[model samples]
Target: MVCDMSSDIFSRQLDFSKFDLIYAGAQKNMGPAGTTLVVVKEDVLGKVSRKIPSMMDYKVHISKGSMFNTPPVFAVYTSMLTMQWLKDLGGIKAIEEENDKKARLIYSEIDLNPLFKGYAVKEDRSNMNATFTLENENLKETFDAMWKEAGINGLNGHRSVGGYRASMYNALSLDSVKVLVEVMSDLESKA
Candidate 1:
């Protein structure tokens, strides 16, 4: 039931009320890959006849305020702290704006750079995952070394794509994108 409305196409296409539950791993756009966020409607449960495990029951968790079990204590706590940080930094809207800006900066560079092309189609490109690869095979090693030395980590594309991917999630700042762009520019200039 939890759809990622974060995608560009889902912006106007979503009707949030239709979903009984909405959940997202805070790792992608929210935080490091260890926290999950859940939002559920009060009356959606008990619609099915199948027996539910105690740990698998949403009603139980909801009834207990999501602390039904010990839970991933530190992970949840950190997620709460991150939420507070977001609030202090002018809330989700401001952070989303920053994320959009970073995506734009990275995507614009990808488009203009002849040596690289995005893995996803123009419309399907993910804001959180900027997947691209070197147009020239010879440049892979150089590009890899350059980016790593420039203090850019986790820019490697998924194995299926075998190229470079700059994941500009919410926690990643504009400064990181700038560093990546500089690396790209340097590589292109040398190429």
Candidate 2:
């Protein structure tokens, strides 16, 4: 099975061994947008009957040492740096714990606050992206100003969600989530 783990890759612990192949864009949990990381089970490659383009073929890429063509040097380097940083912080388990904590803090605030409501089903809510909306649509402007004043950035929800999205990546601290929770509480207080 080929798994695209673009949004959820490193933010939480996963059993990667179950998949025959896994790929993820670096922008979410790794680094920037120009690079992607792919992991393939060596034995699974060249087993497919269908032909793939040379660059798209995992075996060829592996044989070429992942330099079949000029690589995104800056993105790759930054991703390497991120990986080293994560390793320094005790690897996936530690990062997963922090991510879970951040998600919980923000989700708890969303659930308890009268002014906000979460988009996703409670059990299905993403640990990486907590999508929520203001209960009073008219308060959007007020809450927006509040979060901005609190120095929160990138809290805007996707166009489809039409609310707010608090992305709690592994690199994001629990303190940051607490600031958002505080902003939600402050907004509710004014309600």
Candidate 3:
């Protein structure tokens, strides 16, 4: 199976042998945009019977060491530096621990704060995304202003979900999560 791993790339590690290919963009948890990461098993190549265009073919890119065309030099370098940063801090396992801590903090506030309700069930919760909505939608205006005044930005939910989303990516600090929880608690006080 070919998996688009952009969302979960630096948060955790996966078994590479199970997939024919995995592709990701280095923006969510790694670097700035303009770079794509592709991981494919060598055996999967040359098995396709159809014509594969040069630019679209992974084999061609592989043969060129991913430098076949104009590469996004800065994005690639930033990704490498971030990967090195993660490694120096103990790699995927370490980041997973951090992500879990952040997730737990936010989810606990979501559960404890009666005014807010989580978008997903406990077992279905994501370690990187804490999606929730205010039980009292009337407080949206006040709560929005509260978080913004607290120096938080991009806490809006996915456009389709239409509530609130806290993206605790790998680079996000645990203290940031604490700040968010504090904001939520403050909202509860005002309610």
Ranking by lDDT: 3, 2, 1
Greater-lDDT candidate between 2 and 3: 3
Predicted structure 2, TM vs. truth: 0.95
User: Which candidate's lDDT is highest?
Assistant: 3
Q: Which tens-of-lDDT digit does each residue in 74-191 have in candidate 2? A: 9999999998898899898989888888888998998999888999999899999999998888999999999999999989999876788998877788898999899899888888
Can you write out model 3's per-residue Cα lDDT over 19-57, one digit (the tens) per residue?
Answer: 899899888888889988889999888787999899999
The Cα local distance difference test for each model comes to 0.76, 0.89, 0.92
- Residue-pair clash count for candidate 1: 0
TM-score of each: 0.87, 0.95, 0.95
User: Which pairs clash inside model 2?
Assistant: none
- Model 1 scores what on Cα lDDT? 0.76
Per-residue lDDT of model 1, residues 70-154, tens digit only: 7776777777777777778787667767777888888988999899988888898777778998899998889889988998888
For model 1, which pairs clash? none
Deviating ranges (above 4 Å) for candidate 3: none
